[model samples]
Target chain A: MRRSRTALFVLVLALAVAACGGTASLKGAVRNPPLEVGTLSLPGPDGREVTMKAEPGGLLLVYFGYTSCPDVCPTTMADISEALTELHPDQAEKVTVAMVTVDPERDTLERLDDYLGHFFSRRLPLRTEDFDRLSAVTAAFGVQWEIEEHEPGDQAYDVAHTALTYVVDDTGTVRVEWPFGFSSEDMAADLAALLEEPRA
Target chain B: MKRTSCRRRLAIASVLVVTLAACGGGSGGLEVTEAWARTSPAMAEAGAAYMQITNGGGADDALVGVSVDPAVARSAEIHETVMAEADDEATHGSDMGGGMMEMRAVDRLEIPAGETVSLEPGGYHIMLLDLASPLEEGSTVELTLTFENAGELVVTAEVRATGP
Candidate 1:
């Protein structure tokens, strides 16, 4: 009976270790396991195909916005730029910031390039081939966007999109998501912590 | 003797008060402060300006219209960026799922008596549309804001690369 009880205790200890090793908890970040976003191929600012995969051995920071965004989009980009600036040069290089435009009709490749150039250099301006493709890619990350039309005679319109910044690990699993008003310091700290985690 | 000195002191104090009032006091007048605009890319067709307007007098004021140089833009108007209600199903873990964001033109923005109206990002702003040329950073644009009670106030807005 004593030997059986000892064996059961050892089994419980082993199970607990396995469970703890399966997931890594990040500060100020939501742990989302099994969140897989497969490889994405989109047009880069250079008009060439840019395929984004998790095997690149760096974290991917993806944000969705348009070039004509007068406020939130620019603010978020600036925040990301500042956050990257706070990181060490090598650590900053380990992270990639990709901005996917929802307003494909208005945000041409050249225009997207111009807008992103104002904030940071090491970034990707992902342009959609078409509306359908854009929808498919955004749906994979649970992003939602809509184009709000103006009055019947007016020619102006606005694209309303989700403003969250998704952080995906090197293995294609989403690890953290920063909401609209998240600070640069928090993002920098989170990225640093994620960088320290051992690769799976 | 003491009474005479007190009278002189009162006279000097009254003069100082009058001078200070003349320098800054505007009863019921609209004051514009911290006016600024974000720089637009060379190909951008529109830009936005933000500012704070305060009514210093006892009466309320309304921002009626905004006018800029014809060379800067074809027209300028007041616009409010609001987040409209989003679909229930789409609201799951979505930052913007709570509302559908949109910018709409408004006729006027009201400033209550002795109250301040802030025109900032994700809120009220002056939309400069049909830009003749892109607004460059480090440049300043002249804006003419017409108020219902404060008349027209001309303010120079510095073009910035980022929002506050």
Candidate 2:
């Protein structure tokens, strides 16, 4: 299975390169059987419980990280922000970004809001201490997170988590998944194509 | 003499452009270049700074400590983002480079003689904790870096929205 996936990835990479930024070619990894993530009721901005759903004819981006992360999380957010700017105004407006905090103990809803507001104006800060709900969501998205045990008063405990971003299309299906270190230009191009091109 | 002077001038210019830092002092100790920090939002409690530290001296050096100006942040520590080894079964067949990643404080970053060590995103970095104020774009923050051999050297890291 690993070998086959690797082969497919290489083939896709070759095709992407050959196409040379052609329309309908996505830079991210395309989910063969697109993941269906229907509406989820979670705590959203302004302390409101909102139904998390992709807008019709739009896209939804979901990420998992903590605000205290000084390195990777902020970098990814900045890249996403940059990518959105690269998109056409119409396409950009149709996108929604939602972030789930893996370190709920340290990441208050207010902190998440503040951190996400820096990059994008339209942001959803999802945080819940309920392990069952969080686990269900993360497991469905194939995200894993582990918080190191530390003293109760210690605020320096670190969290280990998956660094993948999922892109949900208008149909509430995860069409593509971007890995860590995905460039903003490529992301922007993929997003544009996802919005403009008809799915094969 | 004219040829030697011209060659020296060319070398200096190259150093300026490539290193983005002043030429090494008489001893050619260490040069910190391309130092910058990403701008933080108003309520951001933490930030990070990145740079390339080149040891031009014959002796090796180590970046042992870091501290931000109190006005910029309450404290600073050298950190490294490491990909935690995940259960093979969990990450298997995932093409998204999906894995567990973590960050931890790094005690020392060694720079061998004539070697450049980079403190960059997704790698070694200077983690700023309890940011006193938002690192505004187009602004600069002063950082005091202490090395095993170079003692303490101050560098102004320009605030940017992204990596340099």
Candidate 3:
């Protein structure tokens, strides 16, 4: 009887270890920065108001730029799109991309949808809304933007804004921000790590 | 012999006048100010760039073409944005000019002197073709501008992020 009891204890110890290992939390860091997001009502291409709200619900990856931007916006957006493409189907499903146009004058709902669509071939939808809400999102996330005045009457007039990407988790707290100009591999690794972390 | 010498001097004076006008030196007012350009990131095969070419000189100047590192770009073309001919003002036409915007390469641009001919966003711009890599911010791209009169103007363009 003593030998049997000892064997039973050993079995329980092994089972316990296995259970703890399955629940090991990933070491993903969330931003401790304060956030400031306000509601905005920008018109979509369909002529509908694409209202944006500060939802701490699902994961949010936010960036601020115009569709007319030539270099950095496309690069950043392309990198994100490629990283999303590389993720396993399950991992890809959980992530969401949100773009805000500082130049709402041009990056209308229609334009944002169209611009992001080019970069994102996947059916995974990207959310875009008005400048105010977008500005609020950036402000809350500590993103910076300045209106760049070019020659008058030039529609190509663009805004010089920050090339930063923010990651917000299910709990709606800004978890991390990746600056502009990240290689596809680095972005993929960072995103994968975030996905593996335990739910907050 | 004295009369012959006078004729020779007159011919020389005519040549000097022609040279001065053609070269645009000291009088033609080849003014270039606020000139800028941009390149895409990740070494795009083709990218659009912009600049402001302000000629304070009281005459007109033309930007014929631009030359950067030949190894980096095959050729840099001057481009202007025009409404996509097929574009309709209404409907959910998601497809417009494919791959960014359609940049019609411009062979020449007339910058009226005494006016700031700004080639900024939404205006005339220099398109940098096929980059070796993305134009990293703080990295300056060497550009050589050839004018109709000013010959070649060598300038360094600071590569910065669109919104940084």
Candidate 4:
């Protein structure tokens, strides 16, 4: 009886180890005691104060960009759109993408709505002219951005920022950070895996 | 007098040959391929175009300017997206938020000899400013690329729903 019990314990230990190892294969890092970022209150596309929190039992993907961003911003949005398209209809419905504009001076609410409408219709386009408020929100999520002024005669400037997509769990905790350049298939897989996890 | 006239004719012929060579007239020239553009969002006033440029000749080339149809866009310019350097530590946290990203207009993009320069997303691209109309998916736009030595190369960029 003693030998049988020891064998059973060893089998149980092995299974536990295997289960833990499964999460290691995930494309995005799994946060332990996930990062606590509070709710975001900003101006929505309608120029009204809107509060954004992770869905009660869903996922929120947040990105920082501008309407005039010619390359990376659009590319990342396209990737997210493709990822949602690849998911099951029910699964896709649980995901929401909220894009906050770093260039609020030019990215008006109407401009943002027109820009985001290209990739997905369900996105939350937020903007603010207050830099301090924008700074606080970015600090919470560890996002970075800066503006590059053009020459005296030039009509445009550039805003350099971190190109990362933060995946927030339903409980308003950042669960994963998707870097730029990830494929749509990889993004979809990560989202699916996170959705399967029980809310913490 | 006859000898001097013959020398003058030779000088003129040499200048013509040099001009032709500089204009990418021979077997060695610049080639552009795999041109494409993403479909603009509804009501968007701007769009972007991407392509790969290859220099087959021995001489170096520079993409000086780009032009689109007046009906398609009001103006077009070259732009590059770059990551912000992580040097500042005062305003932003060292671990979470420091690197800021931005894009700026570029006057020229150089293509070295026997090398290929790709204008893909998250890198170099053409910014179509003030679009006359939204870019429809499955459509094509005509673009003319002007180079310092290769003159002009025209291409039809397909507007895709997404990107390549």
Cα error, residue B107 of model 4, in Å, equals: 2.8
**Candidate numbers, best TM-score first, in rank order:** 4, 2, 1, 3
Q: What clash count goes with each model?
A: 2, 0, 17, 7
Q: Supply DockQ values for each candidate.
A: 0.20, 0.28, 0.05, 0.38
Task: List candidate 4 stretches off by more than 4 Å.
Answer: A1-23, A29-33, A45-52, A149-155, A198-200, B1-28, B86-98
Clashing pairs in 1: B28-B57, B84-B100
Please give, for residues B27-112, the per-residue lDDT of candidate 3 as tens digits: 34554544444435342344555555666665577878676776656557676643233223211112211212223557888877
For candidate 2, write residues B8-127 as lDDT tens digits.
557544544443333344334788899999989777788999999999889888988776767888889899999887655433223244677888888888999999999988899999
- Provide the TM-score for each candidate, comma-separated: 0.76, 0.82, 0.47, 0.82
Report the poorest 10 consecutive residues by lDDT, candidate 4 chain A: A147-156
Top-DockQ candidate index? 4
Tens digit per residue, CA lDDT, model 1, B44-83 = 7778898988888787878887878879988788988776
DockQ (0 to 1) for model 1: 0.20
Task: Give the per-residue lDDT of model 3 (tens digit) for A1-200.
Answer: 99999999999997875544322332323343423233433444445554333333345577766665664566678678777878887777777777766766555455566566655542222334444555455555555554445666655454556666766655554555666556667667766776775443
Clashing pairs in 4: A159-B101, A159-B102, A160-B100, A160-B101, A160-B102, A161-B100, A161-B101
lDDT score at residue A97, model 2, on the 0-100 scale: 89
- The global Cα lDDT (0 to 1) of model 1 is 0.74
Query: How accurate locally is residue A20 in candidate 2, as Cα lDDT from 0 to 100?
Result: 42
Could you tell me how far off, in angstroms, the CA of residue B47 lies in candidate 2 after the best superposition?
0.7
Candidate 1 Cα deviation (angstroms), residue B47? 1.7
